[model samples]
Target: MKSKKVKESVTIMTQIVLPNDTNPLGNLFGGQLLAWMDLASSVASKRHSEGIVVTASVNNVSFTTPIALGSVVTLEAKITRAFNTSMEVFVDVWVEDRSGKNRTKVNTAIYIFAAVDENGKKRQVPELIPETDEEKVRFEGAMRRREMSLILAGKLKPKQATQLRALFE
Candidate 1:
């Protein structure tokens, strides 16, 4: 498979938080933000793999700040790493204040997507080549994160996580 640059799969989506998208507290619902993030990340994964991709897992999404209604929420997603048939995508969420003309980062989420062929079987994807400093950082972090995810899911033993072991030892 041909190698792909991380920038080639970047996706950005912006949406205004409407009343229906918010909770009774006048802030955007957590689930709403998660859905938008998932959509953006999936687009990035598909662009990288050039095929259908499904969400394999979604890491924790800690909302640092509440996004008020009417705030313009922007989600930026990029492929961080590609492993076999799965790709790790990092999504950053920012809330923009129209009146202040300022943007504040609300949260960051990690989503793992599995590329599948037309028959719904997982397929190998192109390797991700990080060109930027930020991309390089995320690319290196993805391996450790994936190891943690596998261990948590009971698919991998803690001792098998060589990258993670090196971090602690």
Candidate 2:
């Protein structure tokens, strides 16, 4: 399969926080933001895979700032790296100013997705080519993050995590 550029799989979504989406504290609910991130990242994974994709794991989520009700929120997701059958996506959430002229990053998340076929079997995905310096940095860090995830899940032995071991050596 042909390699795909990270920009090719970028997905952006914008939403206005509503009363129904907020918690009693009058801030956007964490679950609501997670759902939006999931949807956006899934679209990016599908674009990179060129097929159906399912969320495998949410590796990390950082809620840095509270989003007020009626605030304009934007989510930007892109494939950071593609493995044999899975991809790592990074989603950055931003809250726009009242004038919509500037944006403040409020949250960030890392998600993993697996490409699947009609029968729900895992399918191969094209290699990802990172272009920008930020993309390259994310791509390089993906292996270490993947290893840590697997180790925490007991899917990989700590001794077998070469990427993680490199940190100590």
Candidate 3:
């Protein structure tokens, strides 16, 4: 859209569980929740980059609890670190039961996204500004993981590359 820059790219997304999203166990479908998380993370990355963003990779997604049909799920996503054309966003999933007293962290992940231009080519993304200690820690952690992904994907030499690459070779 615009070549704008955001000091930070982060957002919180939430959804109230609906009957149609529930499974036979009367709990929300894990797939559905994951879908929501993906969408939210994508949007958060875009907010920082100010362009069309695509998912490059998602790392370490773990579900620690199930969401009941009547509960509300909140997904917090923020751009952690950004390279020339890629940004890593950290996401944490939380659930609030209908009772209004129990809010639990149920899922967490680090998703990588690439900002793209209208021609569908990858482009540089905006930088991130960490405002809190927690944000700083998460950003630093994401950087480490991003480096590992580059090596695992062969974008960089697993043994020698300090910067993460986008390809395995």
Candidate 4:
């Protein structure tokens, strides 16, 4: 499989937060934002693998700020790394003011996707190539995140998580 650059799989989605997508407080609902993020990241994963993919796990999701209704929401997702049949996607959520003047990052998340065949069996994905400095950082960090995930899932022991243990050493 040929290595794919992060830029090649980057996905950007923009949407306007409507009243129906907001909470009683007029802020964008957490679940709504999560759904949008999932969709955006799925596009990135599919672009990278060029095959069917399913969300394996959401490693992290942080809603740092409340996005008000009527705000423009933009999601950017890119493949950070690929491991055999799975790939890590990093998503950044930005909120634009009603006036469309300012944009602020309100959330970020990491999602893992597993490439699948028509039969729903896991399929191998091509490796990812980090072209920019930021991509390189995310690519390296994905390894540590993957190690910790496996450890927490009981698929790996702490002693076997060398990538995660390196953070403390």
lDDT for 114 in candidate 4 is: 93
lDDT of 4 at 35: 96
> lDDT tens string, model 2, 1-169?
9999998989999999999999999999999999999999999999999999998889889787888888899999999999999999999999986678878988889999999999999999999999999999999999989998888888888778887876544
lDDT of 3 at 39: 94
lDDT by residue (1-169, candidate 4, tens digit) is 8998998989999999999999999999999999999999999999999989999888788777989999999999999999999999999988899898998988889999999999999999999999899999998899889988777778888877777776545
Q: Tell me the tens digit of each residue's lDDT in model 1 across 58-145.
A: 9977987989999998999999999999999999988888685898888999999999999999999999999989999999999989
User: What TM-score does candidate 4 reach?
Assistant: 0.95
Give per-residue lDDT, candidate 3, residue 38.
86
The pairs that clash in candidate 1 are none
Error in Å for residue 160 of model 4:
1.9
* Per-residue lDDT of candidate 3, residues 24-67 (tens digit): 99998878977888898899898888779999887888766778
- The residue-level lDDT of candidate 2 at 120 comes to 100
TM-score between model 2 and native: 0.95
lDDT over C-alpha atoms for residue 128 of model 3: 69
**Model 2 collision count:** 0
Q: In order, what lDDT does every prediction score? A: 0.92, 0.93, 0.80, 0.92
In candidate 3, position 127 carries an lDDT of 62
Consecutive 10-residue window with the lowest summed lDDT within model 2: 160-169
Give every collision pair in model 2: none
